[model samples]
Target: MPSLPKPRLRRPARGRGSAVAHAPEPETPNVEVVEHDGLRWVNIVQPRQVDRAWLEEHFAFHPLDYEDVFSRNQRPKVDEYEDYLFVVLHFPAFDKQVGRLNAAEVDVFVGPDFVITLPNQPIQPLEYLFTQAQQRDDVRASLFGKGAGYLLYKIVDDCVDASFPMLRKIGNKLERLEEDIFEGRSGEIVRDLSNAKQEIINFRKIVRPQRSALADLERTKRYIPDDLDIYFDDINDASERIWDMLENFKEVVEGLESTNESVLSHQLNDVLRVLTAFSAVMLPLTFVASIFGMNVHVPGQDSITAFWIVIAFMVGLLGGMFYLFRRRGWL
Candidate 1:
């Protein structure tokens, strides 16, 4: 047979490539979109109280879910619907003004062909990850080539991984505080321990509820379209590990508080012991001076030799008392 006829060329679009099957979706004030390889990722940043109508207009999420999304400080949880799954996850984001970690809540909706992320606050890692998948061809291929389930797993996994660095920072701070506790810096260490303890408590509050939610993820499926049990398990394991670390930190901080209190108590006892010893030594000398200073017939009041003898006797009494204190181990 002769060579095949030259293929009739279908010209690519004028602006964008042919691989993009649809025109780009317009973004609203609080919403952004990234599409690649037939997968769509919608990211909503800090939606306002009235923005639930937008979500309801686009997605058939439950009213309660919308309430949870717009609400502040919702507990971390996972709610499985008939055609979608709603997940709430938390990560510690530091608040520089208050100088502590605050829980950033991200509500996710996973469906057959799309993944939606609605964060209650600006999460830098989530923002960065979404941007990477949106801008970089390789990142988009790697992340969107997989199904929605796998993409969801990666999103949660990246957030879970970001916590380790914060944990490391907390660990280093505790080590330094442990050293300062013994270096006569208990005054400062007391405040340090309080701040660290508060951070641990807040972080634990974030991780504890989220652990159960992540564990329930694999079972709560509808349109996820992939058997990502292993991937979800990995995220679950990471959440468990984070919770364990926070538990350990709680105990460590409590122990530090007790140790600091003990050090302070010991220092107080040392000061009080010195004051008591000095007061005991001065009692007899004070009585002797008072008696001689009175306008009464004291024994050594009339003679100069008597005054020298009295002075010598008082010096001997002082030496004797000092010797007694040294022998009693109370000096």
Candidate 2:
């Protein structure tokens, strides 16, 4: 069987000062560079102001783009410029404090000879891709051989693809909650559903705008050269697939929530019906006792047998009312 053709990254001229072939040389402890076939992949795990200054010194990125590198809350977007393309994209990172998935921003600068990744927080797939490029020569040859546009494709594509497992998790949770609903675990299921719903909402927020941003990425000028839309198109399709799953999950959770509410309401009604029937039975018995306790002369009030008679009457009335309730299926 034939292997699939890898998308192309523009191969710049192997100019003077290019790093040795297949070596992932580090510019600093935090900044790592992988050079192959005249392309450089510079990855900074979390960029600081000093790193920002280094970038300004090394590259001619616009000041606004530099500011964007430090901004964690920038929405998914793409800014095309004459010299480079500045892209902002979000991927999911589970926050332990919030107990759900949240968007993590990855800011990218793609140029003719280099692709720089600045993630505001750690993303596993991004880290893995960079690590593989660092440790493996074949990995570098295949990835960095493509120009900056194609490298950008790889980063966004991997990050977008990573979301599928998370989607499956959300789907699995919804499935489990559906089963637990029937097992009469309304309390626990309610909380689980809420968490799952929140995760889905967070995931939707990440993917919804990203779809358009990816489309915008495709239209932006090729930084390394022209012709890499196929790669970005693949990323867009993946984003759309994630959005589709979120839509289905939104519907499923809503349905489950409505079903849960109905189950709760039905259980409440059963308890209320029983209480109402018991209260109805107690009303007459209370009236008879009140009359007997009055200071005014009452029939047979002075008789010794009155006490036993009242007790017998009360028991009879209780049994009668209980039987009536059972007959009506209100018990």
Candidate 3:
């Protein structure tokens, strides 16, 4: 294979007194090239903002793939062309205000000699991978030295690994919610659990289809190298693990919701029990007072001691009812 061309460097000044040579023009800021061992990787971030004419002029990619580029909300899939493979993968992107994960789309065009990447959202893992590839020759060699197939593997692997941190954050949030529920601080826990459950569902929506896409890539022909098949398998395994974790999270959130309902029901039942006991004790006293308040002449109506006698009789009746309730274990 022929060696790759070196970057154009400006000639240095001939002598100390000579004027400094003009610096070479910089490449487009949005476009980055990583080259090693005759392999080339071109990564374009946020291609929507870049001029469409530039993409049309540069690469002889399939018309359908280019059309897919302009299209929005494409499902996770891999389409094989004669000369390259077009892959659309969605990764989890968290929304802080909504407290949920959203799908972030990444389009990858993998050809025999080169790979092109365009991402719709700011993917931190991809950014870090590019930075490392730029700064470290070892990283560049390990990634760019291989064919486009292996480079795609690296990108998908990084994307899959990115979810682990977010999963940890959600796991911690769940633990805190469980603690709050048990401590009688469950007022806001219902809302928090609902958000968590929705987040888990969002993760599932992104991960399950992504896992299928990776599985398809593993079986894809022509563009994918034979030896690199195992690497894609590893990526598929990671995606499957993510899906399983999401399922577990959904179950936990459901359990939390059930526990919250039980706790609330028990609390309400206790309140109703206390109210019933108060009403039962007050019923007879109310009846006795009504009798005394009547206009009809009854026994001991003329004696001043009648009022005291009735009061003592009501107090004794209240004590007897309390004793009966205690004996029945209703209080």
Candidate 4:
């Protein structure tokens, strides 16, 4: 809730005979500032609160970097500048309306004294880190005491770590789906599997690109300290691991889908086979009964027991057809 000291542009001292007027400070509503140990962490939530004008006036970020802040759905990337590094990263967020996880972009400006984060939406990980930084002295010290680069790393690390719980939820769903598939209780299992697959795909789409960005960060070694390469390397490794897990889940989903289709096909074939056998046996009996019912029947029409005889013949014919059908494996 605390605010950072308002930044100002320095000017030459006025002459003794001169008078000066000061410009009113601009209003910043979407910006949240957390200051610790002479370090400033500024978080910008959305585009409407600040634009290119504010960004330029405050941090003087590159035109392209601040231009990207107004946009949405940016690809993950890292750009190194003379005094700072501009990094765009995506974090996973669950969209309850869509019933799937989606990627939210976070644009970071890492400088010597401050780290600024601009998110397309209210990102949970960033909010969580902000809260921790405010309440936990250890977290504040570790993040701010080190440097801006380390603080940036901590934010990114938390973002990456947040995916694990989502992934675990997906894993649990898949496990239940697998059990349902084997137990032949596939009611709604297909839909569940589909949902899980979509989440995995969305997660992969969101995260796979970030691995390259993280690797670039590690290789560039521009914003972070030299000793912090290991931390970035570890993050890159985690990205790879997460990607691999998603790929495996994708394969499992495909296999399960194939199996489900196969089972459904087999069951349909069995029903068709039974229907065909019944139709085959009934067709001849119906024909024979129609023939006997005709006014000018040729055989066994006048005998007192002729009705019984015809019924016996029809029964024998039905039995013979069914026997042949069964022998041929049609039923």
- Candidate 3 stretches with Cα past 4 Å from truth are 1-29
lDDT scores for all predictions? 0.83, 0.84, 0.82, 0.82
Write the number of the candidate with greater TM-score, choosing between 2 and 4.
4
* Poorest lDDT segment (10 consecutive residues) of candidate 1: 1-10
TM-score of 4: 0.87
lDDT of 2 at 66: 84
Worst 10 residues of 2 by lDDT: 1-10
| Order by lDDT, highest first | 2, 1, 4, 3
Model 2, span 1-331: residue lDDT tens: 1121243566546768877575453344367778889888888888987688667767878898887888767888998788778889999999889778888999998878888899988999999999999899998888887677777888888998999998898898899899998888876678888888888888888888888898888777657346676777777788888898999999999999999988888888988997898789989999989999999998887798988999999999999989988898888
How do the residues 24-77 of candidate 1 rate in per-residue lDDT, one tens digit apiece? 654445667788777888888888744565666677778888888878858878
* Predicted candidate 4 versus true structure: per-residue lDDT over 1-331, tens digit per residue: 1334476677768888888868786665566778888888988787564454556667667777766877775789989889888999998999888877888888988888888898888889888999899889898998898888789888988888888888888888888788888787664577877877777788888988888898898887666779888888888888888888899889988888888777777878999999988998899999988998888966778886988988899999988998898899897
Question: Lowest lDDT 10-mer window, candidate 3?
Answer: 1-10
How would you encode candidate 3's per-residue C-alpha lDDT over 1-331 as one tens digit per residue? 2233344666654886788777876444466778778677777777753434556656677777877777887898999887778899999998777756888888988878878788876799998998899899989888876677778888888988999999989889889999999999776678888888888888888887777788898899666778988888888887787788888888998999899889988888889988998899999999999998899998888988998999999999999999998899878
Alpha carbon lDDT of residue 206, candidate 2?
Answer: 83
Better of 1 and 4 by TM-score: 1
For each candidate in turn, the TM-score is: 0.88, 0.83, 0.88, 0.87
Which stretches in model 4 have alpha-carbon errors above 4 Å? 1-27, 49-53, 185-187, 323-329
Compute the lDDT for candidate 1. 0.83
- List clash counts for every candidate, in order: 0, 3, 0, 0
